[model samples]
Target: MDELAALTKLERVYRESSLLCFTETWLKQDIPDSVISLTGFTLVRADRSEVESGSSDHNLVNLLPVYTPVVKQQSPQGKEVMIWTEEASEQLRDCFNITDWDVLCSPHGEDVDSLIHCVTDYIHFCVENTVPSRTVWCFPNNKPWVTSELKALLNEKKRAFLSEDKEELRRVQRELKYNIRRCKASYKKKLEQGMEQNNIREVWRGLKHISGHGKSGDVLQVIGDQAWANELNLFFNRFDLARHRAPSSLPSRQAIHPQLSSFTPQLPAQHSALLPTVTVDQSTVDQSTSTPFRLTLDQVRRELKKTKARKATGPDNISSRLLRECADQLCEVVLFMFNLSLSLERVPALWKTSCVVPVPKISHPKELNHYRPIVLTSHLMKAMERIVLSYLRTQLVHL
Candidate 1:
């Protein structure tokens, strides 16, 4: 206990441990609990001599707590049919004051831009009205195995501690410790039984807790790199050796004009002379001015089929599951919007808005280069792009 107190006074890097076993502690029966307590850890043992033979035991203490997990009761599972998306869509219609089928079939139903705006508004409504999940416990919570009996014993121990009743505190502390250890043993036994009966989930849950699956990573003790961040930064910055692009603003879309005709010696009015020259056939110009590829119902259906369910939404909080579920009816409307977007040669601003999440490549990543960006954009816009890309690939293959 004296050695443990001395060790606690010294600075240490990390202290969280799931299990700590103590061997020999030359502890006397007259020792007080207040002198041998660890603030944040649970006591597992003192010594065999003190408990069994009532003789003084002399050995060092190792402070460790082994947690045993028991099974948790759960409700039966059932199929969940969610209506948030449909309600959101209906809300969108109400916001636009449009009747059913009007926007999809009406000739004057604004363009893709208008449809995107309505969708974005609906997403906002859904997010604003949705309820957030609740947490059952806060940080520094008691262990799951702690019970009412243990809690009452703890209160008695506390009072004895506060009153400076050393002998009484030691007795109460010993009882409290014994009960907690017995409870943990029972919990561990229950887990072993569950495993023997093929309860995989319960077994895994207990194992994860025992292994400290969600605990914070221990910081590395390198001389300069700290927790791998410094070395990672050095490795990532080596690629910035030279500039790849000119340090000037560039045109967003530079016009490309294929040389229609190369100027050469024109046949002098009187002197008939023919010089070889490159020329553009009429067919080349016709292809350049050709309309944007028209999206078909089948193409829309194929794109919708590729949509994934229950994915994170983008700026427009609409879910992919919603589109995939009602693909048959929604494809016609989405296809009409897509065709209009193609003919007009413009993509809506809403379609361009994206949500970017930066994910770290390694533990304790520091620099911007250490993170990879994941951009989430409009699902509808992606579908339309897929169709255009498909058409372009077909043309390239023929070429």
Candidate 2:
């Protein structure tokens, strides 16, 4: 409704055009006709649930090309998407008033009351702004890797091919071949450099481009909420999208007990009863060898700094880049939320939700099981988990 209202404001743009199409209208039967009525155009759409009902309610965007007598454009394609790239990154920084820092250190102080005040303000700011977004539009790559000189030569070669000039065709073909070789070599060298730097994300991005999977697919055909939930459990109970691996080495008891697969070892009954006798020296506490007493601003900051900026976000729709950029101020809110949850022994309802994405793991996978699920959780929830993890780590020492 917001979009259609905005489009109505642009009467001149649509009035001048012959045909206008919306691929992702978010329209359903529940929406009243009055809601979608536009002055200068008719709307045609298909809902995901209605399209080929045998399949899951996914990828259901009805696409029709924007028609205009003014140009030869036809064939509507692609779903609506918010692509996180340099453009989106710049927009986030501008919207949040984040500045470039020489060091990505988090803000800290010993006073909890003061931290809570800062956090309350930050939460209000987020609620007012909502999540920063810019819809991505697919455009042809007019800027080719080939030089202008080579392009001119290619045009001449095209003229030769059309005019049946055999000698000119042969000469042009040789030059084109050399240019192609140079382009491939240059691209290959860049890929090698990314790999050598251990830039896994960069290397993976280049591979996606090489495999012709860089383009975004139909957004209208997106996975439904229920599907995302089931898939989240399937992926995240084990947490694959995180790519977190367990330690290979195991304690003697765990190694010998098959039931202890991924479970933490517990102290025997005799030892459990005597835990009160243990003593600790606060001055001798070493983070390198012991669990933290509580989550610190520094711990949250370290985790955010190490996290990838471009990965997908969860129910809150907060991007990793946004979290990392605002870490200095945001850590307070995160720490506060963690402490509140711990004290109350209850989590926010939103934290319980997730966004599950299906990624094709194998080529030409026909079975539903072939698709791998990648689960994304709320950034706030992750922070809460990290805090709990500190407690777990301390407790595990007894076993």
Candidate 3:
């Protein structure tokens, strides 16, 4: 509405003015009717090509052009002379004001280069030649003093620009801080909640499933669960892309257990005929040994119970957890037998010291071989034990 009102006022002013200047009116020659309806300014077809080529929009004045009157005066003895009227002379003087020209030429910091060059050329032309001063028509709404007023207006403009820049900087900083803090807090909180570690075995299985060669089917068809499907598909796509860029040595699904079959059986009579059986003296072997080695599972379990009781009464320390973990790993390795001999007794202690876990003797339905079972890595066993313990502890604490 404000724009419409302003346009109306401009049209009125332009119609009242005695001088008019236009540009780019040639292309809009047929648009004269629309212009007249909109602005009520008279359009005159002053040139031939403008009408023929419909180029009236350019170099076409809608208003009358202002002109200076040519006057003649007779001097004494029939001598004739011409001089401008007082009004014309005053208009000329106003247009050629040296002070106005100086002001126009003065340095405005914002537009220093091009504006200075233009003003310098203009002032030089006026000073060096007999130049007649005349006022050029501007658009009715165009501010004639825009060039001279630029420096004064720039003070507030610069302040506004700086203020806007500062605000934008503050906005961006706030967004950055929020995103970074949110991401960090989410990562740490998920760690504390044990989300990633709890599902690690499943994650490994999903990774294996994604390697189509291992799973023997497409991920979507193999994993019926929607969440698992999504995760598997995403990981598989990532793996495929990464593999294309740089191939990774992915581990194969071949079982790492040794089979105890494929051997020819020897007959008892042949075995007896081939060699003589010999037995070593146990007394000599025991005498030669320096260490007593009298450790038992009961004694080890007793040590564990004592440590737990002590830690229950006091705050748990890092060393305490380490020892507890060692005890757990010791238990995981040793399989109990009713014979209760030195082999059974030495197993747990040596297992603990050796830092090795025995192969899991699981009899799951998924097992392919009855004699051989999978040997899990020590690291994997330890990590699994830690995760389960921590998860149970967290649940208990919550309860």
Maximum-lDDT candidate: 1
Question: What are the lDDT figures for the candidates, one per model?
Answer: 0.61, 0.57, 0.38
RMSD of 1: 14.4
Q: Could you tally the backbone clashes for each prediction?
A: 6, 5, 6
Model 3 lDDT per residue over 1-399, tens place: 443234335565444555444445343435454543224444544332554323332443445334322221212133222233455434333435433533553454334334434543453353234323444333222221233234334444456544667775555555555655665565456444554568664455444433433421121222136674455445435755676786568643333223322242346786787787566666655654554433355544334433431231111112232234334333322212111223333222211221211221343322222123222222222333343365457444432
Worst lDDT run of 10 residues, candidate 2, spans: 53-62
Model 3 bad stretches (over 4 Å): 1-271, 285-292, 295-321, 324-399
lDDT of model number 2: 0.57
Candidate 3 clash pair list: 25-56, 25-57, 25-58, 26-55, 26-57, 26-58
Alpha carbon deviation, residue 168, candidate 2 (Å): 23
Query: Largest TM-score belongs to which candidate?
Result: 1
How far residue 144's Cα lies from its native spot in candidate 3, in Å, is 60
lDDT of 2 by residue, 93-159 (tens): 5644553221221354343344434554454365345444454333333223455566678898889
Prediction RMSDs, each to the true structure: 14.4, 18.8, 38.7
What is the Cα-based lDDT of residue 169 in candidate 3? 59
Tens digit per residue, CA lDDT, model 1, 189-227: 979998999998788877866766653333321233355
